[model samples]
Target: MRTTDTLNVIAANSRVLVGPLVLLVVLLLLFVFALRVGIGQIISLSKKVAESKVEEQVLSQKLEILKTSEESALPLADLSLVAIPSENPALIVISQLKNLAGEKGVGLSNIEAKQTAAVASIFHTEIEVTVEGEMGSLFDFLKGLGSISPLLTLDQVIIRQESGIAKVDALIFGNFAPLPTTLPSITSPLDELTAEEKDILAKISSYSQPVFTEVTPSGPFERVDLFNF
Candidate 1:
C-alpha cells in the first residue's frame, strides 16, 4: 500500500510540470517570431531612409543649378548677334562676308541673297557668293566665316583652280530672329551659360565686328532675281 501511494504522488508531480513546460515552449516561439518581425521592420526602414537620402541629394543638385543660372544672368548688350533681333539680315550677312573676305585676302566677285520661307519664329535667307583667292586663303576665309557672329550655315561649296587662283562658289543660309514686342523677363533659362558654353561665346566674341554701310531699306527675305554664273 505505501509503494502504491508513492507512485500516485510522482504522477501528480509530472502533471503539474507538464503545464509549465508547454507554457515555456509557447513563450519561446512568441519571442522568436517577435525577433524576426523586428528585424524585417528595421531592414525595410533602412531602405526607405536610403532612398530618401538619394532623392534629397538629387533635389539639392537641381536647386544648385537653378541658383547658379539665376546668379549669372546675361545682359541684352552682351548677347551674340544671332540671339539679338535683326532689322536687315541680308545686310548683316553681306557686311560679315565683306569683312571676312578682306581679312583673308579673298576677292568677292558677286554676292546674291534671296529670302526663303519663314519657319517658326525664325526667318531664313539664302546667300550665294563667288570669290577668287589662293587655295589657302579660300580655306581660311571659310573658316573665319564659320566663327563669325550671327552664324552662317554653309549649304554648298564648290572650289575650282583656274589660272593659279582658287575660285569658290558658296551657298550659305542665315537665320534672323524676329523683333521682340517686349523685352524678355530675367527668368529666362538661357540667361546663364555653363563654362563650356561661355568658352564658345568667348571665342565668337574675340572675332572682329563687321562694319555696316548705309544701304536701301529692304524687307527680310525679299525675293531677288540676281543670277551668279
Candidate 2:
C-alpha cells in the first residue's frame, strides 16, 4: 500500500505540470519568430542606407566635374557678354553718341530717345536724336559716327537748305548686341576680322553710300535738322 501511494503521488504531480510546460514552450517559439522578423527589417534598412550613401557619392563626383568644366570653358568677360541684360544693352549707346559728336565737331542740340519695337522680334529700345548743324558739320558727324567699331547703320535722311545752314534729319541705327568677347586665336588685333569680312563691310558701306542726301525744299516742316543716332 505504501509503494502504490508513492507512485500515485508522482503521477498526480506530473499531470499537474504538463499544461504549464506546454504553454511555456509555445511562448518561447513565438518569441523566436518575432526576433527573426526584427532582424530582417534591420538588415533591409541597413542596405537602403548603404545604397543612399553610394548615390550621394556619385552625385558629388558629377557636381565636381561640372564645376571644373564650367571653370575651364570661358572667361568672365565672355560670360558677361553672353548674359547681356535686355533693359540695358552691353554697348553704351549714349557714350558712343557723345564720342561721335565730339569727333565730328558737331554740337548736339535736341536728343530724344524713344523705346521702339525691334524688327528682330527681340525687345529693344531705340533712341531718335535730332541734331541741328551746318552741312559741313553734319557730314563730319556722320563720317565719325559711321567709323565707330561694330558698324552703324544710317536708316533715313531728310534734308533742307535754309539760311546758309543745311538742316538735316538723319536716322542712325545702333546694335545693342556686344562685340564678341573672345577674339580670334590670333596674335594681332588686326586679324580679328577676316579679309573677307572687311571686304563685305566695304561693299555694305558703298551700298549705303553717303547716309545723308542733299536738302529738299518741299516739306512744310520745322527747319530744325533732326539727327537720330
Candidate 3:
C-alpha cells in the first residue's frame, strides 16, 4: 500500500509541472520571432541609409558643377541675348546702320520702317533707305550693314554706279523674338556649350553694340520752376 501511494504522489507532481513547461516553451518561441523581426528591420534601415548617402554625394557633385558653370557661362548667355534681341530691334538696327554709313562715308536718306510678323513667332521690321556715295563706299556700307549685330538681312539693293558716284536703295530686314515666359524643368540636365557654340558666341560678341548718348535736342532753353506741372 505505501509503494502505491508514493507512485501516485509523483504522478500528481509531474502533472502540475507540465503546464508551466508548456508556457515557458511558448514564451521562448514568441521571443525568438520578435528578435528575428527586429533584426530584419535593422538591416532594411541600414540599406536605406546607404542609398541616401549615395544620392547626397551625387547631388553635391552636380551642385558644384553648376556653380562653376555659372561663372563661365553667364557672359556668353548675355551675349546671345544681345545677338538675338528680345524686343523689336528696328530702332537699334537703324542706329547701327547710320553709324556704319557714317563710318563708310555714305549718306542716309528716306528712312522708313514697317513691321510685319514672320514665321517662328518672329517679328521683322522692313527698312527702306537710300545710301549715296562713291561706289566703293556704298559697297563697304552695305557689307557693314550685314555685319552689324542682331542681324540685318539685305532683301534687295539697287545700285547705280556712274562717274565714281553711286546711289543705292536698300530694303533691309531686322527681326527679334519675344522673351520666354516659362522656365525649364529643374530635373533636366544642363547641356554644356559645345566648341562650335562657343566659337559662334565669340564671333557674335565681336559685333559692335550701339551706344546711345542722351543729347538735348535743340529747343528753347527756358528755366522752368520745379513746382510747375
Q: All candidates' TM-scores?
A: 0.52, 0.38, 0.65
lDDT of 1 by residue, 1-229 (tens): 8999999999999999999999999999999999999999999999999977877776666567667655343332354665333654777778889888888998997799876656788776889999898888999998887777577779899999888778999998777776678975333333346687766666666656555458898766645665632
The local distance difference test score of each candidate is 0.75, 0.58, 0.81
- For residue 120, model 1's alpha carbon misses the true position, in angstroms, by 3.9
Worst 10 residues of 1 by lDDT: 184-193
Better of 2 and 3 by lDDT: 3
lDDT tens digits, residue span 50-74, model 3: 9778777766766876787677665
lDDT of 2 by residue, 65-149 (tens): 5575454432332333323333443145555666677766666655555554565634344556655577788877766665553
Lowest-lDDT window of 10 residues in candidate 3?
Answer: 184-193
Which is the better candidate, 1 or 2, if ranked by lDDT?
Answer: 1
**Which residue pairs clash within candidate 2?**
129-227, 130-227, 131-227
Against the true structure, candidate 3 reaches a TM-score of 0.65
**Which residue ranges in model 1 land beyond 4 Å of their true spot?**
1-77, 82-84, 180-193, 212-229
| Best model number under lDDT | 3
Ranking by TM-score: 3, 1, 2
